[model samples]
Target: MDAPLPPPLFPALAAPTDRPALRCGPDVLSYAELARAAGALAAGIAGSGRVAVWAAPTARTAVAVVAALLAGVPAVPLNPRSGERELAHILGDSAPELVLAGPADELPAALAALPRVDVELDGEGSGAVPPPAEADPESTALIVYTSGTTGPPKGVLLSRRAVAASLDALAEAWAWTADDVLVHGLPLFHVHGLVLGVLGPLRRGGEVRHLGGFSAEGVARELASGGTMLFGVPTMYHRLADALPGDPALVKALSGARLLVSGSAALPVRDHERIAAATGRTVVERYGMSETLMNTSVRPGGPPRPGTVGTPLPGVEVRLVEEDGSVLDGSDGETVGEVQVRGPNLFSGYLNRPDATEAAFDGGAAGGWFRTGDMAVREADGTIRLVGRKATDLIKSGGYKIGAGEIENALLDHPGVREAAVTGEPDPDLGERIVAWVVPSDPADPPADAALADHVARLLAPHKRPRVVRLLPSLPRNDLGKVLKKRLPRG
Candidate 1:
């Protein structure tokens, strides 16, 4: 009676061919091989309501997820490094029918209760490739958990439409085509790695080469061997920047690539300049979160703004809202506001948490917009420059609203400062005084607090200077290189 669901998220697998689809270390799968393997697995798990994947950076992980999509079942990607308590919470919340993992993967104790299915890298399906699933486009495809900075992780229900919309939008923005080949060593748990990295390549009818782990040499080797694009976080770029000076091959490989992208956190302007100076290639930046897949990205042909994440993707509407929920009229480039977005890329809701989900969206006569909780300023050119998170990176001092990201960037420019984080602490006179936690390049001869304060005051406004400075051996960060402000010492 109802119109059939749109074609499978990955149209390349429908009529499998011998074109390369995926490569992880020594393992490789052509479109036909992937279809046969995933189709067979899909037939076996067709009725499974949901499945959990021990998301390892391996070929098996990709096959497992594709199979689940073919079966019209939701797949929950579990971070292989998640703590026991976190794992237990996710397992209980999702209540997957079984767990799919690599043949040699050693899952943690929390996954012991679930039925286990080992995904074989070389096992092709017994018969002809099965047709794609005919399920509703609105059906949940994946249940990815949040980083849970505010509280325990919540499962974000991503729909088939949302995933397809996001990938297609990115394809348009990046000028992605079937002739492209992607290279990355990111983990499989997060959307950047699994969805954008793995699924993106397949949806484009292209190939993806996963390094299993990141390395400058590995990146060079792949890019030299026909890899057109490289996807990495800031940490990975930092390493490449460090390696570029000594490794001409690395520089050559990077220079020859069609695109280099950095996300998960802001790429410091200094690092951007270093890589560009050496390789003549600028690393493109994009902004997104678990709730919304891909909001904005610097287009392939557009100006590669170093600090900005570029304009909103095709079909995505972005708005900057004030504290009182009123939308700002236009971009001034200096006025900071909370980012809100509405588009097909948005998640359906948090799994089994209606109250939380209701609170997340601010709907009005103009449709619902998901609050990103990220603070940014929209440049006059329509590009968005993110300062930081609303909760941790926005600081109010001396009747001024200062973004900690700017000050951190300024501090990073200092030759003495290696890593920096900025936070605001309560003050008797200023309400909230700025604090700078820095890791010096030379701890034995660390820069003086007053000197650093003077440097910041001169670079920015006097009021934006750090009132307190704390020297640290290193900044506490997550796996993705995002600093953990809550974990920093207050005293």
Candidate 2:
């Protein structure tokens, strides 16, 4: 009998008869019910390695994913609402022969149009127990794709060991209970939502209330119903803050959460302060990338320093190095270098493209360290504040290199600016110059170019400043809150 090592992800689901695992609107699935559904789907999938899941948000997608895992097939859950071209690309890239998908009442036709393999599992099954043959810890468990700023996209391959280790590490460090209800809606494509949103909560036996669409009203309703935790991006937080700025009832509903987490991209220090005051629940700012899962996080009620990603996580080792891949001098707190990490959770490699994979390890020679392209400067207290990505997000102006992220942080601090993107524009004098496309909080009251320039001068070094400022109602972005600065036309 082949025995799969007990998956670290299903301590809660391990005993399906013990509790209710998922609640999607009026539908509530117990551990037992979900286990049964997953088993049927798993049996149907058998072993195709990867299966495309085009289902809308339901107990169904969750069921299919778990089932696929049980049957030794890796589940590739695509965003069902994408265009035909996008879906076709996914199908072509993944090369999945099977797809289990359906559109429920809450899910519309748009979500159902993506390629899905239909399977008939009437929800009458119960191989909830992991396969007797434990899955290989080193086997490819997940393949998450990130839309590259410069190119099409790259598939980040994560192994089962990495996924299991990451989840186990999180559960051991963060205290959670079966009775806690976590409100989550971030898409399943990205690791932030998939690993943390689904894998982490389920690992701890916590009840998850996964929503398809996010709105203050909808979130408030769920929180009011006793959701103990909420995870969202900075944009989502801003919208929630806007919808109910300083309402006590709204705050209470938000505060009812045991934890409020903000991640995916850098959270503006200004927005963090405002939302913290409004809700009275300190938001735990976390740092993560598609390549490496979460690396650092700011604890609630700590000093809550501005612009710093505080401390390395458990079982995680971090080091700072120069552009030439040399370690930074400990004496210089201002020494900015690339962030490097070696951990159990580090990615194996890009799905294909050996050259790119080799290039990713530029800084990691000694240990199994994965080179994170983002540049960072270390503080005396050991918090690593990210400057920007050296790969595509850096801007050069007047013979000096500038991190667009640094300028964007300064722009978000302004009362009138809601969002901003900084990019390089062709300049004959300097190699390239800084240009910022800004989204004003109030479109009717746009800031003048001079006023914006003055604002930039206050925080950034002269060379780091954006010489060209354009006023726009909103900056273009991807499915995630990442600013698509490259897409904004330069004047």
Candidate 3:
């Protein structure tokens, strides 16, 4: 006999309650209303194989995703800002049966070929909760496409067990409960914004308030009212840090927030200090990727470390391995190794890419460890500090391994530097020379190359100093505000 299936992912939706569940701008949905709306939508989309959701930051988008989960159909979240070429590739790769979008959203020409269903936030239903789909827990619940850095984007298959495990682990780490309200302005397409930000609240029987878009004023207004937590990317927090000095309301709101979390990219130590100086609250950082929902996070009541991404969540085992596949024994905080994770939070596999999926794991099929491709240093206390990606961030110069993230952080500490990114380039003598691309705080009066290089040498090591510094007006960035190092121009 086989093991029994787990209960519904969102048990709060099974019964009627007048408590608010979701809020996007002025639109609000109580638990009772959300259940009826999602049940009706689920009934219509039942047996629809796989569906796509236009993940706009709205209550309707949330309903569509919930309906798909309730009906046991997989949902592929499409980024509304994705280019036509990228969107076309994803649609062809996933081959969703239908697309679900808000009633007022105007999709681009690339989506015209697919069938669409307009989700109405205020639509009526039978006032009955839909039964959980009778399916194995290992079945796919979401197919999230990764950002295609090396090649075309591949669809990642995430199972219901993985999602549930990740959420439960996070709850234990953060001490999350039904009384906590999460406030964020993240796009609903990726795991940080969708799985943790939107679905997390629903699973915990809490409320989520999505700011149509992120703004310092909106964050202050919401947190000042009743919001308890804030989830944001580095860019969003950087803006908050910049605005906190001038906005008293923002400071008060942040000081009162139970938790302020940052992910998707590393939050600079400078930004963390600035916010703490103003609000007396420290921002917690977590590490994760598309293949792994969440591997590590700084516990809410644990020690406060600004540069590290805390310890692994409960049930997630994290290890650093050498190039020869030997696992590192102890955390010394100096040795850099590739991050490998094994846990229930791991994804099933990549959709239609068996070769890629197999390549992502190490030690054969039985190993069960997913190679994250991210490089990090484990501290003495078991905290993980991510240095950078192996492909782009690990710089081998002068017979030494150097991480670009630490150099970038040192550069940002200089008063003249506004933004910085580090990469390695081919050199005649050194195997790979360290190069620094900097955005000066003042374009009219940029810091000299010698001064900046000497600043880094004094703060870090002499060998880690940039061999060459290129000053730019601004650094190229993505929608989530991560610096696009690949797009940086080489001299």
Error of 3 at 69 (Å): 0.4
lDDT of 2 by residue, 1-491 (tens): 86655554575555678476776666678777777676667666776767776546565666677777666676666765566666666666777776676534233343344445554334654466555554677777777776656665677777777787776665544455666788877777678777788767776787788886677776887889888888888888878777666566677798777777788877787777777777767777777787778787666557767677777777888888776768886834455677888888787787766677777775443355678888777788888787778765666677665777778888888888888877777889988888878889888997777777778888876677678888886778777687776667758
Task: Arrange candidates, best TM-score first.
Answer: 3, 1, 2
Count clashing pairs, candidate 3: 0
Query: What residue pairs clash in candidate 3, if any at all?
Result: none
Model 1 reaches what TM-score against the true structure? 0.98
Measured on C-alpha atoms, candidate 1 has an lDDT of 0.91
Residue runs of model 3 more than 4 Å from their true location after superposition: 1-5, 132-134, 365-367
328-369: candidate 3 lDDT, tens digit per residue = 988998888999999999999899998999899996434579
| Candidate lDDT values, in order | 0.91, 0.72, 0.91
Looking at model 3, report the run of 10 residues with the lowest lDDT sum. 125-134
lDDT of 1 at 470: 97
Better of 1 and 2 by TM-score: 1
The better candidate by lDDT, 1 or 2, is 1
